[model samples]
Target: MSISKNLPMLSILAFLGLWQGLAFYLHSPLLPSPETVARIFWQHCQSGELPYHLGMTLLRLIVSFAISMLLGCSIGIALGRNEKLNAFFDNWLVIFLNVPALVTIILCYVWFGLTESAAILAVILNKVPNVIVTLREGTRALDKDLLNMAKCYGFSHTKTLRHVILPQLHPFLMSATRSGLALIWKIILMVELLGRSNGMGYQLHLFFQWFDIASILAYTVAFVGVIQIFEFAVLKPLDNLALKWR
Candidate 1:
């Protein structure tokens, strides 16, 4: 437990040490020292460029994530609970699960005309199938005894779902949520880099054009720091709250 608690800081320090050693050994401009990257990161934050791009990325991330979760959960629950619906969508799910994310993004941009809507839609399309599969398995694994008890007590659908079904689904929901954040954020970066003109991905693309390795690494470290903060400060607490009974 002590190891688990300190693991984040320890791992980060170990990674930094490895990175510093690599930079010292390679002696290449492409692999700037961590100190150089840190300097660049400080410069960008002072100039407000990093904040603006990061904010835009966060907005896109939130919109896409919310839509994906809402749609994924609803469809997943339907497919999970209904045999006929599951049968009907099983092939489609398989196809989608196998479909390349790049193909979906390109198709959405082509069909929807390169708008914000298209970018978010692309992310949603790629993510929904995974959520559906996870939740379906969770539904299948639900305790039949609790379900029968709810039925025998004459529980309404909403009440039964809240009191009996959802408690069992907490683990699956948490799993899907954590996975979704990881994936959707990455997809958002791709969407932004490929089509949109703002966000960290676009900034990274610009830096790539100029071959500004330090700036690229700086933005990368900054964005990842933000994500880590969210995971620890927000999602970790939510996970504990949801799954504490288990």
Candidate 2:
């Protein structure tokens, strides 16, 4: 309805135009035209191959995201509330945070013998630290006055959490969630690429081996479209609702 809404479409069109032009000029197998990619994408969809692989990757992403968010938020809140605990685990968090994701994926595959558990574990390990850092800062920034008020009112821990603590932490939780989705999905791709028998990443690997550029781009575009849909349909609405109290 507005220019802001139209801008995304316009930009996408301009990108396609540029890509089409470059692709035509290059006439290269490495950089197939968008139309070629789209055609392959459609064929994959019609054959159900795309959906199957995409679903596998999505499953891993969802599981890893859930575990990372739950564990990270709980641990972050505990550490933020206890100075001694925070001090002790601070370096541990730093160590994990600084660990390269590729190395983690490789180690998990080596140690766990390329099982699904190891793949998911690798993704969780890689993502949890990021969530911890985000939520720890949020916990530290919580309103002391509100917490004291809840205490004075004889509120139970659960009640206080639901009414006073959680409301304030919603923004940070959303931040972790959004970042988690992005980060976990990527890690899952690497996990899939390294260890798994099936998924978008595995399919991409096969495509790479055959130098199937159009197929590779098709898978990438499809996954990105799915991510975009999720952000718009789920995360954005949830963010707006959660922050409405402010």
Which candidate leads the pack in TM-score? 2
Residue-level lDDT of model 1, residues 101-208, one tens digit each, is 999999999999889999989999999998889889999888999999999999999999898988888888888888998899888889989999999889999999
Computed on alpha carbons, the lDDT of every model, listed in order, comes to: 0.91, 0.91
Model 2 lDDT per residue over 1-246, tens place: 698989989999999999999999999999999999999999999999999999999888888888889999999888878889999999999999999999999999899889989998999899989988988899899999999999999999999989988888988998898888888887887788888899988998999999999999999999899989999999889888877867
Candidate 1 lDDT (Cα, 0 to 1): 0.91
Could you tell me every candidate's TM-score relative to the true structure? Answer: 0.95, 0.95
Q: After superposition, how far is residue 199 of candidate 1 from its true place, in Å?
A: 0.8
Clashing pairs in 1: none
